[model samples]
Target: MMNIKETIIFAPETFNLAETTRSIEVAKECSHVFHCIFMGYSKKYSYLIEESNFTFIHLEPHLSDKQITQIMNVDQMNGIKHPFTYEHIKERVQNEKRLIKIYQPVSIVIGTTLSMFISSRVCNTPLVYIKPLAYTRPYFEEGYLPSPFTSMNLLAATIKKLFISIALRITYKPKSFTKVAKEENVSLPKYTIDALDADYNLITTTPEISQVYNLPDHYQYIGPVYAKLDVPIPKFFDHLPTDQPIIYFAMGSSGSPNIIVKLLHILSELKVTVVCPMKRMIKSQLHKLSFNENIILCDFLPAHKISKFIDLSIIHGGEGTVQTACLTGKPFLGFGLQQEQRVNINQCVRFGNALSFRKKDFTKARMEQLINHALSTRTIKEKALEIQQVLKDINGPENAAKFLIKHFTVT
Candidate 1:
């Protein structure tokens, strides 16, 4: 048996800890597992990973005075044609190498929006790219951004694309485009590895049905690996009227507090019971709303457990949250903010299991209207059940482990 050393790196704030947990479970079967993370190092995650017998490394960059000044300069010159130079790329590449050497792992696993794209080129190590949650297709079709490029003729669209491409090359050098260009020009250093040539790219989605990007042979859809938690219902959940349906509302970790307040107010006007995860910034705001016996507030609740009792969920469309909602067979009313959330909302809508609203479109009246429409719809409910059945049929984390063992183990 070949003993392997593996490192999985990701940002701490992302809601993909369940996926990381799954990865660790698989890694332990044949190798030693190490975790690399940034920011958000909570006791919950630390305790969880410790129980799995994995080592954790935290990287929090403390910028020097000179480096801070340089970063400020880069920020100010946002419009500069060449914002990121060879020097910038070199600095990042060196930093990554230093971090990896501390662990001395045989292979690395990366999650987050662009970590794979950056690390694969910088560290020159074998890597696996985990897909973050996103909308598949139908959501995008309904959610349109006001685009000058799309409105103009084909010539204008082409011109804008060319201009944006050049601007991106200048600002985010050593990005996917520049990496490919550098390889072709023989400028990529010997230490740099092309992610396009990676051994495998594992996506946490069903590619057979997802509409975003085609699944290449190198890319495998491994389904959702969300962490499951058992949440004890507080006294509040039990007292709420069991006759009427419950609505779950959360703005995720970084969502705007104002939005949460607006949602609470809208829910109070309706007959449905509203459950919100108490956030500090919005606590006072929530207090101002007249409490109908229907409002329930708590600091934190296990979303999966709560979804079982709730008929609908209003969320920021975080991948983990959305997947949990799907597992419980509950339809969602997604309020998407970031690009990734938009993608998740899109997928939910495509699956016919959710509806989405952009942050800008969320008004008290609009929210009430949307919620009422969803409550009246039987199709969404049916779809939710179908997706729930699909989730039940798959052994998500186990299957993902099997794939990793097959491809990553060195003979």
Candidate 2:
């Protein structure tokens, strides 16, 4: 087998530590040169680089933005692209080219939106899209269609309009940054179609639960790559109360803190264990909130381990988090923080495995109602359990590793 140098470019702050670390570990097994890029701050994922398990090279993150907030809001799919934002695109394009030249990367794996767009514009690098950065499904996939003309019925049309509106965000660029590429160089993709133009599109979701259909030959649905957290169990879980229902909740990076705090208060009062893994920034605010013995807070907790005790989960509609909920045989209530989450929520609800709510539609009573519904509903629980078996049987990480290795071996 011939081993070539491979550079894995991840979007800063979006790609979690476990997925990146495991991919690096797997790539090393085949003797590929593994290089990574990260920027800003990631207290949760930074430990992978600091604690060495292999020879992974650290590369600079692409920080080319005309305005920091503008780029973030745009990159986050919360903002529209500025027609006059030529300099910013050029810098990003130049930065990507520079990194490609420096590392001499053969295969580029993207896990976020901006990186996906960057890879689309890259000249020769083969892109391996790991997960959905946008809510694009296979063209023939059955369910709510995004196109205005395709909706055959009134309900379908209504849903299509709703999802489409949510997909388009009005982002504001807060501050500008240093330019790495020239103003005259790069042109950004205007649509999801242009952004996803890659050599390989690897989906981590299973076909059984997905609305996506008619995948092309280059695309692969390998199942869920659930994060493997080494963090110890929280002390609250030391004693088990099997009688009452328990729920694991995460607001994710994009979730609103005020909403989470409000929900926590309600969950605490419901006489059930609410296991919430919070980011450190939210740690202080949690002190102000009241909690009963059933409310447990931690900096980190393994979802797989913790899900054993949880009856349901509440998440900000991330794919990885959804996979965790599904693979653990627990239903997750998707509280969408962004537009893309609505895509996942639609699919999960369509398949009858999970419940969902848009943030705008959220109220304390609605949240409580959804929680109670998921817990009491047996059909969804059964479907969740069934999906769990399918996900386990698929062995997402191993199969994904194999797929990555095969690309290296063949080419």
Assess each prediction's global lDDT (C-alpha) against the native: 0.57, 0.60
Model 2: how far is 95 from its true place, Å?
A: 3.7
Score candidate 1 by lDDT: 0.57
Best by lDDT: 2
Question: Candidate 2, residues 1-411: lDDT per residue as tens digits?
Answer: 755445554433323443454454334333443444432222445465445343333334433323433443554476875322445444555556666677655566655434334533455666776775345535323444423435589887767666655544323221221122112233443444544446677777776677556677878877776566656777667686888887888865555567777777777767577777774537668557677878777676777777677788888777777777887788878876555566666567777788877655456577778888887899988888877777777767666667766774344
TM-score, candidate number 2: 0.77
TM-score winner: 2
Residue-wise lDDT of candidate 1 within 1-411, one digit each (tens)? Answer: 854445444323222344455454444534433333332223334445555555554333333434433433442342334323544444444455676666544555655323334545455666665555232122222222223344568887676666444433432234644654364342432222222334466666664335445544766777776655434667776667777779888765445566677667667777788888756547667556665667777766767676557888888766767777788787888876565666677677877988888656556678777887777789988998888887766655666667766765555
Error of 2 at 406 (Å): 1.7
